[model samples]
Target chain A: MTTAKRDTYTPETLLSVAVRVFNERGYDGTSMEHLSKAAGISKSSIYHHVSGKEELLRRAVSRALDGLFAILEEEHACAGRSVDRLEHVVRRMVEVLIAELPHVTLLLRVRGNTETERWALERRRDFDHRVAELLKAAAADGDVRGDVEVRLATRLVFGMINSIVEWYRPEARGASDREVADAVVRLVFSGLRQG
Target chain B: MTTAKRDTYTPETLLSVAVRVFNERGYDGTSMEHLSKAAGISKSSIYHHVSGKEELLRRAVSRALDGLFAILEEEHACAGRSVDRLEHVVRRMVEVLIAELPHVTLLLRVRGNTETERWALERRRDFDHRVAELLKAAAADGDVRGDVEVRLATRLVFGMINSIVEWYRPEARGASDREVADAVVRLVFSGLRQG
Candidate 1:
């Protein structure tokens, strides 16, 4: 093998190739042969870095989940008024989602057909509930309108945020990450109606 | 077959069962055997009704697209002020989504794996652009905020609206269709932050 190709073949780099294929063919649809071909490495070589496709899946979701859960640990997420903290979390979520688009997109599409998928789903639910609690607190503080149920509002807003995976192309000449986050926050905090 | 079992089996009824399994198992993972097992009917019986799995997928997405496209043709959608028309379409959309929850859910989850899936995605994009135009008109009339890009706003709003399929359970003691529509309209029109 050439030195340049060999140098670029770390587990992480192989993983980037694996994720792109996985997203394209789908997790279940993808096989080691597919990854092997996509990575330009032998199947045995892929096995050297990871046990199998499941391990790769586990690693990808773990990264995405860690990025999401880390947001809750930040001082801005924990301190300040509930509404302001919620805003901080919302904005950071957009950033994290953009930064880890493929990983999170894969995470969102899991169908719970396997052990790793179920675990990923449970962790996702936990993250959602934590964010929902912030919205609930904001509602209780009367800083957010109480007209809409907090739980429903949280899910819908999340739906809005998470739906970014369906369309936001990091390559597209669309709005930047900060710009999209600003629009989301503005719409979330204030309605689309004329003031 | 018993009279009750005979009564339970129809193309529409069988399609419903197939859609549920298609959602639980990713469409690619699901097989004719899986549908047969889920429906408690033989493979031959299923073929007797709809040809095959692709037919079920086609029917489900067609139903969803039809519901969405019909919204654009409504009198309120066409006759009123741009903002009001958009509001009407948005409200009707939530109702249609709830009414045809499973079908729409299947439509949103499609990954364009086949010719049928690709067509569904194209139709979905067309529907989105049609709504985007309404938002643009509302912006032009100065009835909606001009600060956020209209195309971006349409997508985020759609992301929030389409998200209902993710969590809404017709069986659960959650908000009714009207209540959810009200919340969506309120959030879409006004800011979620307190005045």
Candidate 2:
């Protein structure tokens, strides 16, 4: 049953609806029927915009990955001292994640159950490895603590940054994204103890 | 399909099998048939051990929650100064999490889609609230920093701890549990920057 609104269903908008459904029902659990219903369109209309749900997933994750990878090319991320650049990247990651919340959330939840998911997983690891290298460089510069291994510190820091998606609601009037990013920087660099 | 090995399938052993399958396939995605096939037993034989998959989920999460709650009742967690007690609870949390990785992993992934999952999520919030209280007390005592809000600090720290399940493998031959816990404690109190 195609409605007159079918004219409004561009591939980008359809991908947005698909990502929300995927986040709710899970990438593995969601079917095209669910996507069509959530999108208020027929399955064939969805197919007309994109090849399948997997293409929608690929598009969604690619958007998130592009946002993240773009941060590394920024001047602050590339030109500062290792620790400073690391901080810039961390702050930008929070901003990017908040700005692209749904897409990144979907990207984070992929479990490599399909070819598209596996590709997303591989890119995620590459992104993580690049960040780990920054941490390692900081350690070598004696700017960061040496007691914790670079790899372990990288994982824990990413863990702290990523877990923001679990509780952050832009509508909640809680901490602003800037405030949250500030708190993360403070905690990651100076920790919770009184100085 | 009930073999002579049916005699070997106690409720606890069967619960273990069910939990592994639930973790892999997700609780909503798993069916009784999946559990039975994974356990190498017939559906009725599996049923003899528990009421259903929900019972298995309840049992698994209860084990994890109990381990965490028990940490609060310990002497170090209860009897020391607030900051010390908070530290004790944090260390024990890492230990308990590593010891009960699969159960807690399953618990962390719960989305409240079912009554059992909703109960688990509620209890998890209760647990988080209790830890937040300790951090509040520590800040009141001037032992912890006051700039970051207690609730936000509690969440960031827990996020770092809870994310341990995503990558930590007991077989990885990387950091030992003690070392990992020590790193977490140091990172929380002192942070990544060098003096």
Best by DockQ: 2
Model 1 off-target regions past 4 Å?
A: A2-8, B2-8, B27-37, B40-53
| lDDT of each residue in B1-195, candidate 2, tens digit only | 355678778898888887899888889889999998888889998777788889999999999999999999999998878999999999999999999999999999887889999999999999999999999999999999888989889999999999999999999889999988998998898889888
> What TM-score applies to chain A of candidate 1?
0.96
Alpha-carbon runs more than 4 Å astray in model 2 = A1-3
lDDT tens readout by residue for model 2, A1-195 = 255688878888898899899998898889999998999988998888889989999999999999999999999999979999999999999999999999999999999889999999999999999999999999999999999998899999999999999999999989999989988998898888887
Scored on chain A only, each candidate's TM-score is 0.96, 0.97
**Residue A38 CA displacement from its true place in model 1, Å:** 2.1
Screening candidate 2 with a backbone cut-off below 3 angstroms (N, C-alpha, C), the clashing residue pairs are: none
TM-score of candidate 1 on Cα atoms, chains taken together: 0.90
Clashing pairs in 1: A189-B192, A189-B193, A190-B190, A190-B191, A191-B190, A191-B191, A193-B189
Q: What lDDT score goes with residue A13 in model 2?
A: 85
Query: lDDT tens digits, residues B1-195, model 1?
Result: 755775679998998898999988878889999998999888998888887899999998899999999999999999989999999999999999999999999998898889999999999999989899999999999999988998899999999999999889999999999999999999998978887
Error of 2 at B131 (Å): 0.3
